[model samples]
Target: MSTFGKLFRVTTFGESHCKGVGAIIDGAPPGMELTENDIQPQLTRRRPGQSKLTTPRDEKDKVTILSGTEYGITLGTPIGLQVPNLDQRPHDYGEMDIYPRPSHADWTYLQKYGLKASSGGGRASARETIGRVAGGAIAQKYLKLTNNVEIVAFVSSVGKVAMPFVHELEDEEPVSAEFYDMLNNISQEEVDKDITRCPHPETAEKMKETIMQKSAEKDSIGGTVTCVIRNCPVGLGEPCFDKLEAVMAHAMLSIPATKGFEFGSGFQGTKIPGHLHNDAFVRKEDGTLGTKTNNSGGVQGGITNGENIYFRVAFKPAATISKDQETASYDGAWGTLAAKGRHDPCVAPRAVPIVEAMAALVIMDSFLQQQARKASAALLPSVEIHHSLLGVPPKK
Candidate 1:
């Protein structure tokens, strides 16, 4: 389905080489200030040709607000946004008409629909995410205005070059103080300083070098993006099948070329026993409950705990490389395919905004869902129950 979210539904449309691409965003709060300017910054960040590491698609990605706003204020109706695809070159993908690119969506798309786009990856292209980034800009604005939520994502690793991490044997020790400090204070400006989008200076240089080497060889490399959501409202996710982390994983993995998702301790937690891994409850300066350790990633039992929600998303290398490869055609004929197209050697840098955008969408939807539940529950009369029957510890 093209739509996502229960309360804040978004339906994205258009293909890679289409006339344009955009999204229709429904359920945005009325009377809020909204304009193309609010959404353009993120789109510009996600656009290609920003650096030599990324594809040279040369899209301006200028967005236009078609409706759902009057005098720069949302009217509580569906918001229509569109971005023109100016630099499209369908001829570049002429070779793909016969042979499907390896490790790409080409074969599966053909099998599912019995037809496929003639140029580029069509819907599978990173260009498809333009709508997501646009919609997320609105949601992020609302979240910041209402709850002061802050979402930041940056390239944490490129290929084998990664920031330091605690090993299984070192699980007894918490994540490094430097790592925590970075999460607490990192900003988009700091992240964008380096083209790699890795806040750490040395690591960003190494990642840049790796990407340049891959581009020189007409190859591609993959990496991970780490995102942190701070000041998220408590009780933002369901306690069952729609656990906070579960939906987050679904959202992150939906991006093209994404292969893995993990939050908090994730797989590392498996090595530590329950006692050591459990996040102990503590009272904070705000007189609210908090966690002594954030092994739960600010979410426990499927709900936000008013702490920072952090996660990492892994994206595979760009499948369409300029190098020649041995592969079978649609008719099972063996041949050499020298893929011709503008493609990123390393997608992690470009993926930074996409990751933040998806995280905003997930958190925004969860926040609205919980708000609706609370509003309805508040209408009901209070019920008195025994402390033991409640199955929760008594308040201090």
Candidate 2:
């Protein structure tokens, strides 16, 4: 259960308040230049105390590579990475041991294991995502180097505040050209410009104020993260069970507090008839082919359509609020409790990197799986893996 991916497998370890947490990445391609530096950016973005909207736990989260690389190059072995827990406050969370916080893993974790950590959600904490970010960074590197693929995620909304008309489209209509252009060029640097990471200046300010206001009220709020995968190669997903969008949805929902997942037309498509919802095929100037509209979000029939892959993930508000709320103790006795210790007013701002990392892991794993399938088919010349089918041009 701790492991993710089939070929590019990452087995995560450690708890939130444990000595450390990290992952062991197996099946990464050989001969890629990788080091601790390549992984730290995403970890830094994911770390707490960076903004007023998130938890104020100060952690450097410095990652260390213990194996699987030499002289900056991967040796095709398991890469072991770790980051120690710097700020552990068992005293602050001692109340959780007595009673489970509402809408948290405290109760269920205790019930299932008959045991629990003295502080935090232990393995259930968002801190556990450090390994995923690190491993996803590696995968992102591979994907970028090989295929020019780029993945970026940003806070789309917070509480009642959302990006202007982010979901304003009708079910029958295709995505707007403005959104396509905006997402096509949106970068992590641009998203990092504001604390809320909404990209739009006015909406970002509103989101920040909402978060700060909620924090002042000793409450919490939920939000959404929109992610885009630009220039993804085609024919990466396996149909039936392992569709590209399906794997992506699974990866996203696995993140802490993620409540919903949608891509392209998503739920909105159900409102319109299939005729108008369909994306018509169009030819490119380079004699290539692409869809005139990207209502399918660059994926069709469980496979990449060689267009920009975009999606949104919905994250619930942080379960732990400073305000008092009624919840049951371990023995089922109910009482009012005021949550203590550091927690985010809104988790969406910090979750931006997590969303990007998870998406990267999915794309990278899909790419490797496609590569393996191609190599296996090399014995039969009659079975040709086409450019449109595989999203890779024939090598000269």
Candidate 3:
């Protein structure tokens, strides 16, 4: 199904080469203040041609709201949003009609649908993510107001450049002008700016030089993104069927090029013994039990533990590159096709917003689920309280 969610529903539409693509969001709460301005920054971040390392395709990615609001606030109705296609190169993809790009959806799409968008991979294009990003921004606003939860994701790796380990940034703190100053002050022409977007000048310079050289050679590469969620309330998930992390992984894997995802210790935990990997219980100043180490990544028993949750997503290289390669056409004839389009040498930079959007969606969904569960529990005659869990009062 193209739709997601039980309470805050999101349904996406349109194709990459179509006039435009958009989404309709239903079940958004009323009176939660929102504006087109709030959604623009995210769309801009995902827009094409934002930097030298990304595709040269220029798109303004302007969003228009068609319904579900009067003035600026949402009406608690289905919200409709549209993004017009400003820069389309339909002719540029004519060759692709016969020869599909490797590692892309071209061949599989034709196999499944018997037809594919002649230009820009249509529905499969990363352009389709505009709806996701816009819808996610709304979810994020709601999540912030309800739980004060914050989600931040940045480039953690690009090609070979890996960022040194650093404490995750807090979400409650607003990114100040100083932060913008730091980003603007970066001297490298390429956007990777060190695998982690860490703003280390020397590393950024080398990272840029490397991407430029690769771009010039008509090759493409991929990397990883690490997302951190903070201040999320406890008891925010339904276990077994709808585990929080599983829902999150499903949403993330739906992205165009994501290849892998792991929460908490993930695969690295396998190397450590049970004692070393476990999160030890400790008494906080408030006398609440907390984990001294976050090896669990906040979620225990498929529920939030009121600790910072972090994970990593690995993105595969952009498949469309300038170099020639051998491939079979729709008629099963062996041939050569060189990618000819404005494409990114590395997609890691542009993917940051995409990752953040999915992360917000997961957290928001989990928070809503928590509310539903609490409401259901309140309806019961008796309840049980646990000393291990935070938030809420003991059952009376």
Give the alpha-carbon lDDT of every model. 0.90, 0.90, 0.77
Whose lDDT is higher: candidate 1's or candidate 3's?
1
Candidates in descending lDDT order: 1, 2, 3
- Model 2: per-residue lDDT, tens digit, 59-80? 8999999999999999999999
**lDDT string, candidate 1, 350-376, tens digits:** 999999998999999998888888899
Clashing pairs in 2: none
Compute the lDDT for candidate 3.
Answer: 0.77
TM-score of 3: 0.88
State the TM-score for model 2: 0.95
Using TM-score as the measure, the top candidate is 1
When 1 and 3 are scored with TM-score, the better candidate is 1
Off by over 4 Å in 3: 166-202, 381-396
* Superposition-based RMSD of candidate 1 using all C-alpha atoms, in angstroms: 1.8
